[model samples]
Target: MENQTKVTEFILVGFPSHPGSQLLLSVLSSTMYAVTVIGNACMIFIIRTDSKLHTPMYFFLENLSILDICYSSVITPKAALTFSLGKRIISYNDCASQMFFFSLFGTTEAFFLAVMAYDRFTAVCNPLLYKIIMNKRLCVFMVVGSYLSGCINCTIQTGFTFSLSFCGSKEINHFFCDVPAVMYTSCSDTLVNEIVMLALCGSIIVGTALVVFISYGYIIITIVRMPSAESRLKAFSTCSSHMLSVCLFFGTVFFMYAQPGATSSPNKSKAISILYTIVIPMLNPFIYTLRNKEVKESLKKKFKKKGVFFVPLLRMRMTTVSN
Candidate 1:
């Protein structure tokens, strides 16, 4: 490894070939990034200001929105740049930093989703004790604990990855500094690195997925036992949005990282990455708000308060007077 020169920088081969496709993709990527930021920001703002949404469920949702924004930012900007400017050169330190934050926010998102599932479980299976169990302190503790755990995981993974001697190829065949992509460029043995990555990341992904599955299992049983159709429907409605979110997030993640070996093409991986990083963040706000009755009501009340609903009516009356 010492015989080969150490790589100080990496050139990312982001979406190679097809100039027309790249241009279109750039436009789409930029649009998605804007939507992701604004949508998540609106969710956070709405939840914070709406007193009615001050429950453990919304609290965790707000945390998830924030995480979506953060995790998307770590990957989307570089991807967008690749499309727009075709500038894919990244410094070694910058690559490491990107990987660190990506891991941190990504891991945090996984845990937060698990916590949200638990919140839903409590709300459905034990409604009477939901407020008592998911108190403010516990909520704060869960959020803080997720971040702390992410930091520790990121530290271990990033330290091990960068410690290797990267000698041969500095050109990564992906948009951003993904762990596997970077590892592929190393001249030194990546057996331990790959093993460690699989162990840590697999645990986080599989563990959270199991928790969500179990929570939903209990929720399903509880809903089925309800005597009335209305009661079951109402209970299921509360969980539908969360279930969609969990499926979208975890499905793409598992496909991208949790596979036994790399069977898919790099282009397929990139497409999946775009789905999880760009599309999912933008979709979260719409999914929760459009599907949620409380959120819709809150939005209507907010718009009504600001005279958004009445402005058109007033304008019509003024036009009639002028005529």
Candidate 2:
């Protein structure tokens, strides 16, 4: 199909063309985007300034929070702009770049969550050995490792996706430059590309999900076997947030990637996209930090010392709910 005419650009029809609904969605997403940035930024600031928050858990927490910021920034702004301007055309190179960073941040977030799961396993399984296992050097290595994995996967996926020649309809039915959605616009046979996608993206999703599930599974067992009710409850509470976050992140990811080019309606894909790209990032800080008492206390103390009069997006909501 080398002789087939190729598409140099794709027009994204992000949301439905209904004026009222488009207006409502743009407003809602803009508000969510603002909240996502503020929440994640607050966590980053709190983790950075607080000496008490300088542990491995909080260190990973900081990385996660920042990832949320970057992750949301990737798709939300462009999405909002697309809705507002009513111009959703993206150049091939620009689309490739957007998909690259989106995948990069997204994959990094998944691995980071897995790393956090491992950290929790250490904290719960061997509290004493946690220090030894999760030291500064190891933490640094983990962060670096996650970033590297993300970059490699992003490069592979983006390279392959962009290499495919687009010979069919130039209209992309989704809000953002998702790999599968873009692949559907290609007139070239994407059999090899599809296999590469399964090997790289599919493996990451399945492998990471397995690791996280196993980690939490072991954690639940350990928590149940604990002698003290208080200890068990606290451990369970801590794991709940991470577990919920994992489900939200991976559920949408699996749904989108597992079925490549299955967009019956662009609106449905936009709705699904909201779960992982927008909503999950906005919720991650709340899951990882706001639910933890230590993080709250640190934030409160820092706010008091700085005399900062910022509205509490999320106050210390540390309830001792049993697992």
Candidate 3:
């Protein structure tokens, strides 16, 4: 205890160092944040308004988009503000809260993505059972399960991190209060926490990755075995976007968490984190909308209707004014 350093808060040094970087970082991050919200919102709205997207695939996609929005919101804006103000101080309690939510959302995403893979598998491999297998109740339950897993993971990770005493210098090496980064600052023994992290977080990442791989593996086989060329092509197309999203989201995740601390680079982690948090979400809507003919047609119909409805109203107003 004598040598223990009491830390009230921790400083988060975010992004590369540069003069007036705060202003630049703030503007850039703010734009990204805005786009994330709008993009995800549009996705949710399109999925909702467009009856054609009323399938299990789109249902899960809507939830995934929403999660990405929140996942980005939890850390990006705060980090941006810190960069903008050139202040990186985060209180102990706030830091723990951030870590908790971040872990929760992230863990939930892993499970959700796994669920999506399974959905794709059923849609491809068991076309007849797709309806029964992915019913409304089942979809709702899956979403709930993802949230529950996230909550439990958050509780465990946050509880573990907070239990340790932080009687030391509070300068965190990373932009966020990631579990490993926080653990490094603790004066108390963190072996248990680290082990839990490796076991729980690692398992979630690896387990989800395994599920996705297996599902896609089976799907590819099923697609190839199909007698009709058209059916095979359509099936592959349907799942291609989901597969791409999965690879991007979880690939960086596994790469970041799977590595040992000795070899992990702060710069690498930050860059990969940016990919998942900023770039991936921005890319999803484009992937789905562009690849899926139904989504494109739906958008066209929605806009066309708006244009037709508004044009008549404008004409009526002009005629009444002239009379």
Candidate 4:
């Protein structure tokens, strides 16, 4: 970590890498990583190509898919490779780079979720001014602001992390170069580091969460006042995906990072890490798209344009009609 540090590399000793489990873990991790990448990539592509999805909500969603792709990539490929690498060793520089990118994308994503909530609020509570308030320029600015905030967050955390002195070779028990796992290996006293970690993780996770809560509150009130049940259902449907996404994402993240000095067994920590890092990324696309009719329609249109699904069905129906 520092000039006094003897360790030039760290071993990722997260999951059991025994022969039998190694094959299974490698295959499973690789599969999940592939799915996560493809899913998020498709999400971004769909949002980009679909004129119907060019609104602020999907615009923010496009950023989210990008973030999901990035952060998951920061960890997943290395992790899957770990099963095959004889020593599962990662050099100091690589580890640090992983940590920085992971933190940057992860933090930016939390802020973006809050941004999405605010977008939802404005669109729901003040439909008339939604266009004016959430114009493209402001949307781009907010996205850039979130990215800058993430850069600042990760730079500070990564700087403080690798600055500590390590007396010997280290094994990072968790899958990735997560802050806590790296900090845990430092021989130097990390009280300040721990406090700093807690503060930053809390503010990012909880702070964005607070924004989501307030925005949703106002959104709910507005929805409750709507005269038509159909409108109410439509509004609720629009929000349901975001709500589920927020819960699935933030719940595991808060438990994992928000506790600064808390101790957990490596297995438990690994399980939680897998949930947020791998599983959630794979799930988010489905979570967001399954409940959104517009995205579904767009996807169907894409398939139809490609002559994949709907067009074939249309041909079968026309054939029946000819008979």
Q: Write the per-residue lDDT of candidate 1 for residues 73-119, one digit (tens) a residue.
A: 89888888888788889998899999999989988988998999999
Candidate 4 deviation (Cα RMSD): 3.7
* Worst ten in a row by lDDT for model 3: 258-267
Candidate 2: clashing pairs of residues: 167-187
lDDT per model vs. reference: 0.87, 0.84, 0.84, 0.87
Worst 10 residues of 1 by lDDT: 258-267
Candidate 4 or 2, higher TM-score: 4
> What overall lDDT, based on C-alpha atoms, would model 2 receive against the true structure?
0.84
Winner by lDDT:
4
Q: Residues 1-323, candidate 3: write the lDDT tens digits.
A: 34332555788877757857668878877788888888888889999998889999999999988998888888888878787877788987789889988888889989998999999999899989999989999999999999999999899989888788877667777778887777776778887877787778788889988999999999999999999999988888888988898899888887766555612366677767778767777777888888777788888998999999999999999999999
TM-score of each: 0.93, 0.90, 0.91, 0.92
Candidate 2 residue lDDT tens string, 1-323: 36233556789878666887777878888999998999999889888988888899889888998889989998998888888778789987889889999999999988998999999999998898989989999999999999999999999988887777777678887888988788777777788877788778788888888889898888999999999999998998778888889999889888777555543445676688988988888888778675787887887787686564433322333332321
The C-alpha RMSD of each candidate to the native structure, in angstroms, is 2.4, 7.5, 2.4, 3.7
When summed lDDT is taken over every stretch of 10 residues in candidate 2, the lowest stretch is 314-323
Off by over 4 Å in 4: 1-5, 85-87, 263-265, 308-323
Compose the digit string of candidate 4's lDDT tens values, residues 1-323.
Answer: 34545678888886775777877877898899899999999999999998888899999999899889888889888887877664578898999999999999989989998999999999999999999999999999999999999999999999999998877658888778888888887778889988888888888899999999999999999999999999999999999899988998899888877875443455677788888899988888999899999999999898878887677798999999999
Question: Who wins the TM-score comparison?
Answer: 1
In candidate 1 the C-alpha lDDT for residue 250 amounts to 96
Question: Which pairs of residues collide in model 3?
Answer: 5-167, 5-168
Output the TM-score of candidate 3. Answer: 0.91
